[model samples]
Target: MGHDRIDPEGIADPVDDLYSQVVVSSGEKTIHVAGTTARDSDGLVVGETYAEQIEQTLTNVEASLAAAGADPADVVRQTIYALDCDAFVEEAYPHVVDFYGDDALPASALIGADSLADPDYLLELEVTAVLEE
Candidate 1:
């Protein structure tokens, strides 16, 4: 692993070191993924609550990564966009922890959006992965 995680002073360090304020990685191949949402293959949205939506969205992200010959462990960075940050932090973060697991966690950011593409859509996920030569 050639990834370096930085947590500078004055910034609150993340719990469990699951995420870093900054992450740097060097690899022969890199994958950029578009924002993934909770919609299933049938074009129907999944999940009634934010946590459910998060799980579905992460699942979609995982599939996308796999399609690119990568996986969660290859992810160097991840960004989450949500309609409700408070609810997501309280209700959804735990699920995210379970989704990625401890060793597979990557550098991440969470953005609170006013709304998503659809009113029923609660969140979206985007990720970048690296594969060393």
Candidate 2:
């Protein structure tokens, strides 16, 4: 596979590997996806808890990327919206691990809101990917 890795220079503190960077470059085709929530493929609400919804939302994103022939490594940017932003590190971290892996995660901006479209909806995530040529 012909590809180039995108490296991020700012680490602020400790990095397991100095050579490690964030994001990767693949094909010329780029996919930009809007924020996907725990809503099912049919756009119906799913999950009852914050964590479950977060994972479901990510799974949705994963499937979308795969459908476009991309993987988590192909992700260039990720953005998440939470009803309660403060709960992110504890609630959504695990689900996010699958995307980040052993390497640095993508550049992300998380937002907090008083609520979501549905009171049951807890989290939503959006992603951008570059498909390898």
Candidate 3:
């Protein structure tokens, strides 16, 4: 398995490694996680605030990664869907940075959306990863 993160010289660096400019990876297996939200084990929405929901969402993503025999470092791409993009960046981004850390940051996109599958859901995460078989 191999994974290489790249930030070309011309492109300005992302603040605090929030994401990579490009991610090149190869492995025996690939994991594609569906959009995950801040729902708990009993199918209840987890948090009231954006930060709290983001934290729980990340936890769900972590669990999905583990179930696929992968980890944060194995993640190559991530798509974040938020009801409020600005709030996500301002209030909830810290939790994301803490979850992935600087070294394991993946190529990511944060998208603003008006609604989700559930009314209470504030954010959703979709992840793609690679791992050795």
Candidate 4:
């Protein structure tokens, strides 16, 4: 698999290190992970705070990626939905950086939503990954 992170000229760079402006990737297999949230196997909300919820959400995302034979480094894109975008940026950003790392960050978007499927869910993650074989 090959993944190239790009920030094209004329397009001002993103202010934060959470993502790249563009991601060019090639691989033999592609994986799409459905929207994942901070829910446990028993179907209960996992956290009361943004930090805790984001961590559980990422854990869920990792499990989904592993089930598909992929990992965080293979991810090329992500969509993040948060109940409170500001709180997510302030409290949950570190967990995100820790999950993907600065070097392996993917093209991403963080959206603020009025609510989630479960009222207790604080965030959701959708990811796309590629595998070499």
Summarize candidate 1's per-residue lDDT along 37-58 as a digit string, tens digits: 9999999999989889988888
Could you list the CA RMSD of all candidates, in the order they appear?
Answer: 1.9, 3.7, 1.2, 0.9
- Note the residue pairs that clash in candidate 3: none
Task: Please give each candidate's TM-score.
Answer: 0.88, 0.77, 0.94, 0.96
Give candidate 2's error at residue 69 in angstroms. Answer: 1.1
lDDT of 3: 0.90
> In terms of TM-score, which candidate is strongest?
4
* Higher-TM-score candidate of 1 and 2: 1
- Considering lDDT, where higher is better, how would the candidates rank from best to worst? 4, 3, 1, 2
Candidate 4 achieves a global lDDT of 0.90
TM-score for candidate 4, residues paired by index = 0.96
Per-residue lDDT of model 2, residues 27-130, tens digit only? 67898888788888787888877678887787888888888888877776777788777677576766686555646466566778777777778877888877
> Candidate 2: TM-score?
0.77
* Model 4 bad stretches (over 4 Å): none
| Candidate models: Cα lDDT each | 0.84, 0.70, 0.90, 0.90
Candidate 4 lDDT for residue 121: 86
The alpha-carbon deviation from the true structure for residue 51 of candidate 1, after best TM-score superposition, in angstroms, is 1.0
- Candidate 1 lDDT for residue 29: 92
How well does candidate 3 score on lDDT at residue 122?
90
